[model samples]
Target: MQYTAMLDFRTCFDARKDIASLLKQEQSSGVDTGADTGVPRQVRVLGQERDGAVLYTWSDVSPYRQDDVVVSHIGLYEPISKVNTVLFVHEKLVNLVNCTVNQERTLLGFTTQEKAATSSSGSPSWHSEGRHHAQVYRSYLAEVQPANRVFYLNIERDNYLMVQFLHGKGQGYGDTSSKESHMLFLIHKELIGLYHMKLSRVGYSGVEMCGQPRTEVLAKRFQWAQWDHQRQRLYYLSQKKKNSNSKMTFTCMQFYEKHPPEVMMEVQVRIYLPPEVSKAPSTYEHLPLSKKVTDQKLLCEVMTLPGGSLCICYQHPIMNPDDHHGQEEDIGEYDVVDIEYSVFMLHRGTALHCCMPGFARLEAVNIKLHFFPFSE
Candidate 1:
């Protein structure tokens, strides 16, 4: 059987195995920055970050001389929406998992393969632009703080990841339904050394096999509209009809506001054959045509939205590498962008596991899902 050339699948055995393997491997070859060392087994511990040390350089950061190395707190989001988590259990099969992480509207890790697939008249190919890298998304989560933004960050698996739990027990079971504890991934870098990261959660709605009672968030109420005046903001009202009193505060941002003006120039000439019009205007804003462009054939082609009445305008992302248009997948996809994110809900499960004193049980929580993939 072919195995993943980059990593050893038999990873994470025990701390003794991890330290012993590290020392053994270090003795033969010194661990240098950017050096590709063999992955060690049992590389994780109950309360430590491992992935941080693996993705970036572990350089000992110098004292602040610039005093301006700012860490911008950005809300990274999916290029499109995601519905399910792809749990990774195999190593060699990484490439087999065909998916579009289109979480950020722009393509990353896509190669020429997916690009060609997206270039057709109806659907242009784009997945082939970025290199195919292993991507993993985990879903089961108990609220650690009762609130978490549903988004993900790309990180290496070999590095130390700090895994926290929902309850203090870290048993990863139940307790106060309210999120209290957390599991973190501590990464290792050659320069920065270690950084802590929290795992992003995905939606798990239909899990009959799990046998536990899972709360279902019936997406019945989703109201959004825009005044489109100078305010440039869109108002949205969403509520859960299945469980009355459950309110959903959803937001969206329209990133394609920078669409190049779609202009159609026409010349108006009343006379059948006017004496050669000899004017070369500096600006061609006004063409000399008046036979109004009314023919449906003359109008640019367009597709109707799902309602069968509304028209949809699909714009491509701006080519600038720095443009946020590339980052408009979730909230940014709306006609307006909001800086504040909030969620307040009151749910009652017809049948939910009531926790026993020291023993907790498996739990499933509902996270709103709206990510839809589109070529950037």
Candidate 2:
């Protein structure tokens, strides 16, 4: 009803019988019919079919550009032979149905009447601020190449449940023209158990198979840590300990954190062990190489700044290759010492800066200060 009033279009249909009856009544009064003929021609209208459902054309308006338009529709039906006789369905109901059918997102749980009720009452309701607008939940996903940097993500209040999955090049499932496929999953609060079980079982596709829900009101504070030291640095630089004038070449890694403006970000950094120390033990040695590689990790927070840079420090011993922090007893005869630095991040749908190799002199080095949210 509000949409019809706002658009100011007469797209509703009046019953043929009612129009005929009205015309006959006007004719009996000797009123001229020539002027009345053009009244119906100005309005773009549609009528109910023989099956009793009214068909109408609908358009999905683009928020960014006015010219970018999409056309779709919705239909409504009423049961015949009703005593109450509220009569035919109105255009406003048809518009509401069209919005739902066309996937034009609105408030997830709250209804139009509920929102109106809260507005009328002037209460601090759940649908306050930008929650009532579909634009608030807008999400964008893109594709990126694998590299070595940490990603700082800031999840919006209710948009966390909108899980998005993207397929890389050659992983197309639906559209051929697209090099990647994207899918969104909305998990409800009540269905979280099922969601968790599915996620633990088969990853994101499990959420897709569980239910194709449009929106879910699932909001809960979650704190967790993940280790992703799977990627290894390909090549590392080593300088002779005795050479004082040796050139130091460092590999630089750039990272980006894409998030909505003004949101705080938290990131976990995972640095893989340097290549030299990670090498297998010599064949003549009695001890074999340890299968597990210990990774050094740190937690960092980012503030409202849109973009920032970070650097990890690499420490190599000059006097003693096996000496680390004066802990000489832990070094074995066959052990080789090395210093390495690496980084990783997820942008669009690709992993970046996962494995970069660099070497530096031994010292108690601090990471770049600006990388953290707060600096001392």
Candidate 3:
């Protein structure tokens, strides 16, 4: 029994030694995570092994591969002076990771100088493209006059960030002397017979919006259009209530908000409308434009519910074998005709859900049901 115990102990020791050797080899091979020594405080050029579940490395940084641009690597320069190093080789900006901190620490993006960040936008000032990020799709855009030298950022439901910059400055066509108008939206909710307007300066960073919720003055700044039915509440990245700049809302648009606000950033102004309990299509008299509504009674029925789902399902019989006897036996088709139904959740307060498909509903016999809990 004593001999057997000794043998067992020896075997365990050998196994542990083998495991350690394997781990050490993995570290050297860059296959095992234990191999990564992390980056040093001082920058250096070493390749990353893999990405996601496996070790993957990019051939280079900066999605732009052109040679006409300049690149810069900005790092935390004492957090105050902020070192902004400009690279003359490439046009697009790129950051290189040189060193790692420790065993548990990871190398992320580089920091930049404060002065470079805050240097001159409207009147030579740096700004941060903060907050208000999203991805919008299939919409139209009209430039606000006297471009505020500000950009708009679009935010989406999936945490996807986008940017839109205001490229010009000056008032629209006829008003050359007026202050450049900012294209922003006023978000609001209605209660009973009353409307509460909340204003925010939304969209991109460079495009600065007036900061206030006053309706009478700012209402004339924007052109209203029929909203696409495939959406829900318009969101904005706000700094402070009654004092903030909002990221613009609409689809398929992104802007740059890469830095911090060099100047005071705030949102202001709003346009409010009272609530209407009925979402069913009303009539041509209630419509904003002909393209905005086909049938008011039908549209009135498609709006979202207070915490309930939008069941836009048409009540027609489906194309299944049970419902479509006329087609008779395996015709080699999907046998599916989807009806339409969209849903939007009420975020606490009572807000009307808008669903305007621009077409008549197929009813219960045939309907295209949105396969999601919320429209994208």
Candidate 4:
């Protein structure tokens, strides 16, 4: 609920560069500086409690931008190596800047763009004339086409997942036309896997299938989605129309390189209101003539907690104002009402549905919910 500031973006960037330079100097001279160097190191503490525990704080600063380069994403890389590194992604490059204390190393960078334009004959341009010798050979996984722009990037060890948007020729960022498609790429070292999907007025549809037709099991646009890097699983909430009523379902899915996404578990979302809020009052004379009690639910947001828990905020109608009421009918119906926001935690199966780390099984658990009241 509360946050404290620690390091800013500019400070972190400069510290990483300084550490990297120190490591390079020691490597060339074959010297172990250690504690003898008398240099102060940067310390980062995270996720500590207040009661007899070290309270580490982190602050989020705006992305660093210089000249034509704009940082699109910034995150701490998974601790696969001995050195702690901060990851930075821009339109054309990915940089892993070391941020370790006394121990430091050179920065790692990768170009995420393709060189040389396509010829007018629709053939490979690199093979023609004098361009063949000048062409820079790069892996398929590292090359992102000029037409596509990365919208999301997630890195876990050697695996990289990038979601790109194929935009029009003159379209800017976040601008999408009807013909645009979203491309999902998963790269493990040199190997590349791709999943392409297009959004239509109805829902989402796959642009290509592996072997057989999969039209029946395709899902619509996700209402909410969260990815768990540790488990390599993705959890999402979607709505399904059953006859006249619509139902929401929470699903756990996993992605594979050679195959399509695998569905792990699915459960219908159910919310049970408290008895006090669900029941209507017996007296109606004190209420406005143009208003009545109604039971309607509206979803606000869905987010994942730290310990693999999910939280949902929604609003339930306690009193509904009649839209058909005329201005001359009653002035009390237009009176301003005070809104109340309340927070409560409910158990799964009884109120919400959640999946556990055990994978296949669905457990009944408690989830926190925030409710907001509305008059209209």
Q: Which candidate's TM-score is highest? A: 4
Candidate lDDT (C-alpha), each: 0.21, 0.24, 0.23, 0.31
Model 1: residue 342 alpha-carbon error in angstroms: 15
Candidate 4 backbone collisions, by pair: 348-365
Taking the tens digit of each residue's C-alpha lDDT, what string does model 2 give over 187-259?
2111111111011113322111122223322222221111111111111122322232333222221111121
What is the TM-score of each predicted model, taking all chains together? 0.17, 0.19, 0.18, 0.30
Which sequence of candidate numbers ranks them by TM-score, best first? 4, 2, 3, 1
Worst lDDT run of 10 residues, candidate 4, spans: 98-107
Query: What ranges in model 2 sit over 4 Å off?
Result: 1-117, 127-163, 174-376
lDDT of 4 by residue, 177-255 (tens): 2322323232211222333433222223211112221122234434334344334355555556422134557676665
lDDT score, candidate 3: 0.23
Regions more than 4 Å wrong, model 1: 1-88, 91-215, 218-376
